[model samples]
Target: MSIFKQIKGFVFDLDGVITDTARLHTKAWHEIADQVGTPWSHELADKLRGIGREESLDIILRAGGKQDAYTDAEKTQLATAKNEHYQRLISTLTPQDILPGIPEFLHDLHEHEYLMSIASASRNAPAVLERLGLTQYFPKIVDPNCLHTGKPNPEIFIKGAAILGLEPRQCIGVEDAAAGVQAIDAAGEISVGIGDKDVLRGATIVFPTTSTLTLANISGRLKEAA
Candidate 1:
């Protein structure tokens, strides 16, 4: 199977797919939960997956039973603080963090002239891509910082497909969160889920991990689904 024969374009999500930032996010969430004296578990963290930092904080706050409503400024402050912590932790990111087969997988898509873009909830996604020398891989980046809403809304994925000059079904979305999968489905696009199996429920196809994805593999899977 050839990717050139199977898909028109590719739309990728940033955090858990292109970069190993999910672990950093999880670590930061644990720290926040500890400091706020709220219990944080994998279950709760999974619940926060694929949403913006502000939204994640709001979810955490509600789970902790905090009824006092914070102003937008207060919420922004918490998200900013978490980002500062995450940035410090991610400063050591290298090409190795690009996942086992992802760089080659991207190259294969590029060689096949598959249009590429990113639809990510992280405001810092572009910076991460720039740091990893992947800015050239994605010309259209639909990030939370540039959008009014994030995943499960379909706005980012829809925008990314538009920028790629491809129809939603002609393009495939690579995501690692439940919200992202739902977002792609809501957008009427084909989505490939790329992390824990449970995160892939609504995705058209689920790859256990990035380590197992190659363009050839993707093409085969896409055909199987079709």
Candidate 2:
């Protein structure tokens, strides 16, 4: 049995899961950090990964020790600057940015009659999907921009399952970030962590990368566990 055999729905995180846009996001953050007169260290950029745009901005600003340095009005100004930079960066995305076997993985899921959806913390998730020509694969999307609460809270994943008309137990949430994996667990859903294994510490199932995973293989794992 493959994990896919038991999963009625597949919930995915956009950036590092289906695409390699995490590096692009990090680059955008670094660019904006420089403009904000803040240093952009790799460690700081890593912390912002897999979170909402507003949340990322908050992290960056706070790390810069400018949380209270700017008024709400000024904070909005900074946010606008960051968005502009990120938007510009998004234009650089090509089909090549999509990870290996990702499109195939999605297609396989669809063929298996698994409902697919995107549940990302990024407000830019919709646009990212559009840019990657992957908008059609995901009929339902739940982004922080569409929710009051973000990841690491589980609301987003819960809402995503709701939109897909599935129970949390029927869906497998795929994520590449620690916060995202945590969110899935909090939602009472099975989580399959992709990419770095360290970040998926508590994840019940972990894969090094989507390229090496197959629906059949995952289904086998699920059956073995059962």
RMSD of each: 2.3, 1.9
The alpha-carbon deviation from the true structure for residue 10 of candidate 1, after best TM-score superposition, in angstroms, is 0.5
- Give TM per candidate: 0.91, 0.92
Give the Cα lDDT of each candidate.
0.82, 0.82
Candidate 1's residue-wise lDDT over 97-179, tens digit each? 78778898888888988899988887777778877878888878875666877778998999989988888878788898888
**Model 2: how far is 142 from its true place, Å?**
1.2
Cα lDDT tens digits for candidate 2, 1-226: 4444556898888888888778877877787677667778878977987877777878988888867776888777867877788788888777787889888888888887889888987778788888888888898997566687777889999988989999998898889999999999999888888877776887768889888767876766666656
Task: Give the residue spans of candidate 1 off by over 4 A.
Answer: 1-6, 69-71
| Number of the top TM-score candidate | 2
Model 2 weakest 10-residue run by lDDT? 1-10
